[model samples]
Target: MKNITYYLKATFSWFVLPFIVLVLASAAPVKNDVSEKEVIRLGFIPLTDCAPIIMAKELGLFEKYGVNVEVTKEASWANVRDKILTGELDGAHCLFSMPFSVYTGIGGKAGSEMKVAMILNNNGQAITLSKDFCGKVGFKQTGKVASVVAAKLKADKEVTFAMTFPGGTHDVWLRYWLAAANVSQKTAKIITIPPPQMVANMKVGNMDGYCVGEPWNGVAVKQGIGFTEISTQDIWKHHPEKALVVNKKFSETRREDLKNVMKAVLEACKWLDNRANRKRAAEIIGKLPYVNAPADVIEARLMGDYNLGCDQGIEIYRDNYMLFHRNGETNLPRKSHAIWFMAQYMRFDYLKEAPDYNAIADKLILQDLYKEVATSMKIKIPEDDMKPFVIDLDKAKFDPNAPADYLKQVNSINQ
Candidate 1:
């Protein structure tokens, strides 16, 4: 019996000892796949949609996909655009209007061709009026109140409105909303202010109103400096806001790197969209290295819960609340999006000459690259690259290829 017990103990020890050694070996430090590759520098403004870029770094999504990514916080959209254009960044979390503006050369010099790898998000922007204007207009959350404010503004002195940049999502949405309410962009003094500084500017009464991404709008409402007059979703539901922008040069030369970056971003977007992961995401983002806002502030819109604090706060739920990956829908570079932006540019007279509109769009929007990355990740791609979309301001129907035809239909003043 003693011999049998000794033999059993020896056998158990042999198996357990080998298994423990194997486990310890597996627990040894993982050599990051990213370390083998050239670092891909990504630029982003501190907007909520920048989640994907941030997540790619924080969650090791880029490393998982075998790419080294460094995210740099940009001060302004113009700086983000210039960096990507000049190769200061390999790519960026960029404005949706940027690719179109660069393609049409509306905001910058003519023929400044840039490419959009993917649409990062849609409709996380809102137009906030200073508290002074809210009190004057008696802006309320419910009823047909916005029109009343619009009428009052029309009758009274022109109010100064603010947008982050010309030909950016904020400018486009603000213009579209103002036009819908019969308020011309010209009627109000629309000036540029960096989004991060919007709330502070409002506090000082430097601007009467401003359109910007979260948590700035939330910041305004929280501070009682301003009220959210209209969410961009009111202008066009799920309207595209920002995209992954790259210079034409980068797109042409470093095709593989671009594709890899998009793939990692797509994964990050998926991770951000999962409802179960959102609170965790907000907490992660709240860390100083990222947006640095209170987790609740970022989490509010991120969870698609909004308080349009005006006369009082109203709860609004939108599925399009700054989506990164609604089954990867936002990641597609649809031609209709380009067409929509073109119509806005024409409405604002940014596109003086039509430069082979479709040709330029095709060159800049790499739908094919998006397709490859989406497929690799097993995400579905919608059949049509271009879909018919209408802007509410003038009931304008934007055709992807024939933007000039769409432009002709608009009776609004064009410069």
Candidate 2:
């Protein structure tokens, strides 16, 4: 019996113990292996969609994933751009079109670069028409703009509009809406204003209409200063709005850290997409230092509840409000979108000549990095990235393969 017991103990120690150790190792959380205790400084502008980055910090998602993130609130996109270029910021919740716009010279020096690591969210911006055009142009009324603007022109009103930046998403959306409405770009003076200041500028009668991201547009409507002529989703459903843009140095040197940070934000994006968590997100982001807006106002649009002012009533966008992660679809930054934005520059005369579209996209969007992060998280990537896409307002088909032909098909102001 002693001999048999000794034999059994020896076999168990050699085989079963090793098996248990291997099983335990396999079940443990895989370390992402980023260097210890390095704080990743990120930036953001005060907008509702800026939630993912801010929430990553609030929910300890960043820390959970073994990263430290400091999300600074920036004043304007231009300031965001300058800090990014200077490396004062490692990354930011940026405009999806910003790196493209900046690289192509609407607001940046030619040949300078900022890498779009991943997209943050989609479908939350809007073009808000001031109280002056309240009765003239109602919600989703893209057709009435021309006639109303024509009347304004004939009356010597010097029709003007505002966008958040020169070649950002707001500018392109505002331009697309203008062209689609047959309200020629030459007809109105389109100017740039910071997002938070948009309502105040319009309140003093500074502009007739403006295009900007949510919370501010929500603020405008809430204050009776403006009404949403069209939500950007009305312009293009699930259109890319903001991104996780990083400086070139960060992308090249701290690739693993960047991926971990992307993972953290992606987790936060998924959490925000849960629907039940949105009001909690709104309340957190509405605090004085973040968006600094009323939590109720922020929560309304955050939940797709738009109480459009100027007595235009309310618009409830259930599925298409502001998507963070639709099963990891929103995080992939497409080169095709980069190309389309550059082409829009051609259409609106922001570019005098056609840019090397593919080359420019290759320079800006960081798809390979995004794939690495999404794949590790077991998120399936969408395959329709390079395929043709159509906007909600027009029948124009944007073929990524033939951007030039699509350019010609869309009647350009320059043409």
Candidate 3:
């Protein structure tokens, strides 16, 4: 009787244990354990615009807000995407267009996505052309070549242009520049290269041009491998750049913690806008683990001075430099911007047809959450949703209220 009882009890224990373990693994936690057990890991690529995340961590902003944040440096945007999706990172300093691209199967598994918590910074990125084209295209701010050099370059050799990711802001900016310059998409090759590797790739004669954020473009000019063909701001003034994108699961399970994180980052954003602290900000990110460049190289560009290189002289941006907070308008994740990005995907034919713009924006941009954080912090939210805005280089306008009209305009452009 004792042996039978023992055998039955052992079988029940084995079967029940597995079920209990599985339930615990899949179930959500009842109590918030952010400060006690969980440390939110934030990842960033080594670019000048990653300053907000690094500053928030360095200036004790995250700690002050009652959340623990570990800022990790990532090699590429792809790594950032993988880590965020795998739960290795709670959030990241990501491209504004990445979440949209990821949701539509350009950058991630189709229908799977990271959420845009808020905008990080705006208008610091630029398109750099290799030394090969320095003489022909010297800082074309409008980026309108009329195929003067692009066609000739393509005709001479297999001209290649690089961007950081597909369907991302860099890719779009590069594509926009090409289209605006009348370079047929078929005539030139557009490839993906990681941001940091851009200058080196150009150094080794890997690609002819690339669109990337600072201080890589700064590094390229500093290294004498490339020149600033066109800054992204010139392409579209105050265009959206990096974002504070949170993992979907993190957003659901750790709402309060995420808000606190945004509050801290908001403080850092305001700090960055002061401009007086920019040198120190540059010093922080230029450290080995952050941007890993000379503080002077990063500082000059961060302060709105672009040594455009190629004897084109410096292009000083007083109002349109790398802006973390531009009188409170830079941080809001504008729905129209989302619509424009999706339209760009269609414009470049990355998407054969138009995506559901409103639906995707609603899913990705955390509008209500951002507003809550902004209101609590005494920051006024900007009312720029679904508004019509025109880009700098071209007259082609984008009105998010009527996306079809915008699509038709972009569709008419020479691809």
Top of the candidates by lDDT: 3
- Residue pairs clashing in model 2 are none
- Residues 1-415, model 1: lDDT tens digits: 9999999889879998889989998999976666767778888887777888888888887887777888999998889878877888988888888767765665676677678888877778888887766545532344333554433554556677789878888888877766655555555688898878888888887778888988888877777788777777766777888888887777888788888888888888888878888898889877777776778878887887777666666656667577787786677888777767777777776666655657767777888888988898799997756766676434667667666777677656323
Which residue ranges in model 3 land beyond 4 Å of their true spot? 1-37, 139-146, 149-151, 411-415
Per-model root-mean-square deviation over C-alphas: 5.1, 5.3, 11.1
Q: Candidate 1 or 2, higher lDDT? A: 2
For each candidate in the order shown, give its overall lDDT on alpha carbons.
Answer: 0.76, 0.86, 0.87
Q: Which TM-score value belongs to model 2?
A: 0.89
Candidate 2: where are CA atoms >4 Å away?
Answer: 1-36, 139-147, 150-154
Question: What TM value does model 3 have?
Answer: 0.89
Query: Can you give the lDDT of residue 281 in candidate 3?
Result: 93
Error of 1 at 42 (Å): 0.3
Which pairs of residues have clashing backbones in candidate 3? none
Estimated TM-score per prediction?
Answer: 0.87, 0.89, 0.89
> What does the lDDT come to for candidate 3?
0.87
